[model samples]
Target chain A: MENLIDIKGVRHAYDTAAGKLPVLDGLEVSVKEGGFCAVVGPSGCGKSTLTRLIAGLMHPDEGEVWLHGEQVKGPRSTVGMAFQNPVLLEWRTILQNVMLPLEIVPGGLKGKAAVERAESLLALVGLEGFEDKRPSELSGGMRQRASLCRALVHQPDVLILDEPFGALDAFTREDLWQTMHEVKAKEPFTAVLITHDLRESIFLGDQVVVLSGRPARTQYVMEITRDGPPKLDDLYTPEASERLATLRHQIEIAQGRAEEGVSA
Target chain B: MTGTLRKILVPTAAMIIFLILWEALVWVMGWPNYKMASPSDLIPAYERYWELFLIMGWQTLWRTVLGLLLAIIVGTAIGMIMGFSRTMRDALYPLLVGFNAIPKATVVPIVALMFVGAHDFNTVLIAFMISFFPIAVSVSIGLSTLEPEYRDILRSLGASQTTIFWKIALPKTLPEFFGALKVSVTLAFIGTNLMEIVSPHGRGLGALFDSGKTNSDYPLMFAVLIALALLGIVLYYVVVALEKVFAGWAERQPG
Candidate 1:
């Protein structure tokens, strides 16, 4: 498969009042076309910054971030992004919010077709009969679902999710994982999910990349293979346990706190 | 249903109780009508001087409305410019804050000098100067509080700055704008009355107060004061109605 996203020797930093603070250093990642890539990292490890870079919301200070064959210059209309907060406009109804991207991107969807597309996406996310309701009227999970529809309605080339389900409870989070898997199965797109939950990464991701603490770099990349579908039972197996142990050990080492667990 | 009824009923009950207490105090004091008119005296005064009260009340109402309208337009524009540009905010915000600190009463004489005996225009000008700062400041604050991620969402979708302003920024400011308007309209009424008092001609309801003071007609003075209080209440309700119509969406709390 061709590489849909390529980040090579990228370094990024924020200039604060004190001085320039580095967030990413010598970062390299290659995601194949139509691949689901999950990046797992500790808090404040620049995981969200990686999504911002891939979405072209910001420029890397050094090296290149290529989407397809071309270098990313600025915000790309072809990329869809969702943050931890749904960021729905309170003034707009759910359907209108879903159609927001179409109104923004020049010469994109509009009129009757836009409405139909937004409605269909809402239905796909189990949000039928909620077209006219304002965002404040919906539950957090429902709002997130509506936002997911908004992100996907434009049919973007890539979808970047930055801790999209991190705010939800355990049960809602698990349910959304299934919903996301089903949606991807229905309509495939290259995806990058930035998360700290190890089980979530292993469950939803085709390839899980562990990232070190700030200034971040890739620590280990593991491909989650299974004979059949990934079940909750799979997490308890010896193979899955071993994989978890290895990744956890790598993360501890990356965070500079792996003294006692290095031999385990 | 009960909430709506309670909103109306509670204020009405309180006003009635207040009026009874005021009447009791006036009766017990046994002051002359010139010194302190009772509620009984006020009713007859209203009947006798209804024509004068109506004309002066209309004058005050129009001035207050016009002045507040101008303030809304000018203040919102200045605020938008300040909100959109960092340089403008940095340059103007401190100056506006300093300007707002000065007593608006002191400024009315200066404004009166500009119009130079144009009573109506002076009243409007004073009202506008008094009311516009809160609108401008609140609007600036509203625009500043917009989540950075909201801008990012629009930007990532390749939205132009104009599109962001119209669709997101303007709508986001509506609740704050209305909140400022509610405060500004009350200030606007006070400004008109203050200018009316200081103006040589003593225009509007303020003229009524000035004349009543000179003539020692306490009943007429009480009548005009009641009219002014009613005017304030009505104007405040106008803003409340507008808030309900425009900012109803903002009131929805997430379950």
Candidate 2:
């Protein structure tokens, strides 16, 4: 399979009033075309920063980021992202919100055609006939779905979700996990997801990369090799329990090491 | 009192008792008719003044409307530009702050004089000066207050700058628009009145007030004062109603 994205030995640091501080140390990750990769880590493991680097929102201080084998310099229009917050525009109706990306792209496709594409995307997310309601009127789950539609409306090649369902109720979050799977199953796109939930990582990911804490480094990149995605019932099975235990053990060791460093 | 009576009837009876006491005070005090006009006297004034007030109010309304329209156009455009770029904001904000600090009332006479007594222009300038700052500041604040997440989401989607402005920035903060308009509309009326007073020739409530002050006809002065107060109340509520229509989305949002 052709690699859609390749991050080669990337390093990032922040220059603050306190002085220089490294966040990512020689970070390396890759994803093939039509792949859905989840990155899971302990808190402050620089997971979110990795997504920013992948999307080219910020430049890696060292090494290179490649999308489709080209150097990542700035933002690529072919990339879509959803954050923890839905971040919908209060004044716009649901349909108009979805159409936003279509209008924002350069030399944008316009008129009836663009609107129709937007409508189709919204319907795909099960938001049909709700194009006119404002974001504030929608439930958190619905608003997040609308945000997803807005991200996908432009037909981006890459999708990045940074804990997209973090703010939702568990029931709603589970519902969205299935909805996301349905979208991916139908029309596959290269994806990078950063999440804290073990179940979410196992359910949606082809591969999950675990990270070390503070001046974080990749500890392990675990490949979830189930023949097909396991259902919610699988969350408590022996096999699932084994994987979950291993992941928790790695994170706990990383946390213990970081606490010793602070004490030192 | 029953269920409805416990709430509505008590308030209603209280209000009626208050009004009756007021009426009885006037009757017992034998106040001069002109000094303290009764409901009966005021009712006739309402009937006689309604048509003439409408005509005169229309003239003032147009002046105020034109001035406010200009402010919205110029202010929103400048504000959007400034808010979109930090460089523009840094360059222009000091000048705007300086202008904002200038007492607008002091400029009205000069503006009126400079325009060679064009009453409409004077009113427009007054409205522009009084209302422009709030509209510009409000629009800039609204534009800048956008969540970084919303902006980042757009960037990831490869949204064009124009679309971001139109869809996200404009619609997301309509409550601010209505808020700016409410404040500016009041300033619009004030601007028209200022110009009317300075020019001393235009036909508006301000001109009527001027003539009343000049002639020492206290009744006419009282009449003009009453009319102006009613006009202010009407203008205020009109903006409030418009805000309700435009900012329904804002109401749904959590504070």
Candidate 3:
């Protein structure tokens, strides 16, 4: 597999009223084509900023962000994103909201084709009857599902999930994780999921990258080895327990609670 | 009752009760019509001067509508410009606030003097000036406070500024826009009436009120006031109707 996204020594800072606040420092990450990269870190570790850099919504003050072997110079229509809030337009129906990117991106789907594409994605997400429903009409979980459809509707080269399921209850989050696998199996695309939940990261990601505290840098990378697709029951196994413990320890180290080469 | 019916019926019932209370008060006091004209007393005035009332009311209505339309165009343009750029907003906001702080009544005389004898134009001008501030302010707030997430979603898709404005910003701002319009329409009527009262253009309900005041015709004066209130109510409902059509999504309740 070829590398679809490569972030090399990416550094960024925000110029606040107080002064410049560094967010990302010497961060490095890469995701092969059709691979899922879950990035976990401490709170305010600049995970969201990393998503923006990948989406080309903003540029790093230093270093490079490459997508498909090309350095990102500006916003790219080939990137799709979903945030934790699932900010669907109140003015559009679920289907129409899903089709929003198609309406904006040049040479994208139009008219009946756009509607069909949106409708199909909705059906895939089990939102078939919700086509004409407004975003507010749906439950939080349903709305998030619709948002995922919206993000993928344009067939973007890269999909970025910026804590998209952070607001959901545990049950809803797990269901979405399974739905995510189902969707990815059908519609292939490289993805970067920024999450706080260790289980979520291990379940959804092939490669999990951990970052240190504020002004974050990649601290550790763990690749999950599974004989078959991930299942909820697998999370209760000893192997899964060991991986979770190790990741939890890594997070403590990242948060500066424990030093490197120390056992808890 | 259905929500829509209740919305209309409640206000209608309340108005009827209010009018009955006023009539009872007048009858109990036994004041002369010149001192206080009840709703019944205004009926004879309406019958006698029906044609005059029609012409004047039409004049006031048209002027208010015309001025409000112009205000919408100019206010939306200014608001969008201010919303899109921090420099423009910073440069223009303080000036707008200062101008809006001035009494529009005082400005009426200045406008009447500048365009002397252009009574209709002066009325429209004052209406536009008085009503545009709320619109510009509301629109600017709506745009500036737009959820950055929505913008990020569109921008990542390489959406142009114009496309974002039309698809997201404009639709999202509609609830606020209509809210401002509800306020602006009333202000427009006040502006038109203010010009008519201050400068006595002899063509609107305000002028009718002035003539009735000078002649001590209390019933006619009351009739003009009623006419203006009715017009305002009608225009208000029109805006509410438009709000339903354009931004109905904002009013939805969770299922």
The prediction achieving the highest DockQ against the true structure is 3
| Predicted model with the maximum lDDT | 3
lDDT of 3 by residue, A43-148 (tens): 9999999999998989899999999999998999999999999999998889889999998888999999999999999999899999999988899999999999
Give the alpha carbon lDDT tens digit for every residue of A1-264 in model 1: 789999999999999999999999988888999888999987898988898898888999998999988899998898888888999999999999999999878777889999999998898888999999999889999999998998898998899998899999999988898889778877688999998888888888889998888999888799987778667777788988888888788788778888634664
Better structure of 1 and 2 per lDDT: 1
**Per-residue lDDT for B123-162 in model 1, tens only?**
9988998899989988888887888878888888888888
Tens-digit per-residue lDDT, A1-264, candidate 2: 879989888788889899988899977788889888888877887888888887778898998989998998987888888889878777677887777777766755688888888788778778888888887778899999998887787778889899999999999999899889888876578899998898888788888888777777777787887666557776778988888877777677667643322322
| TM-score of the A-chain for all models | 0.95, 0.93, 0.98
Docking class of 2: medium
Residue A227 CA error for candidate 3 (Å)? 1.2
Clash numbers, per candidate? 0, 4, 0
Name the runs in model 1 displaced over 4 angstroms.
A259-264, B1-14, B253-255
- The CAPRI class of candidate 1 is high
TM-score of each: 0.94, 0.82, 0.97
Per-model root-mean-square deviation over C-alphas: 2.3, 5.1, 1.7
- With candidate 2 superimposed using the best TM-score fit, by how many Å does residue A92's alpha carbon deviate from the native? 3.5
Per-residue CA lDDT of model 3 for B26-111, tens digit only, reads 99999889889999999999999999999999999999999999999999999998998999999999999999999998898899
Check candidate 2 and list the clashing pairs.
A95-A131, A104-B159, A104-B160, A105-B160
Better of 1 and 3 by lDDT: 3
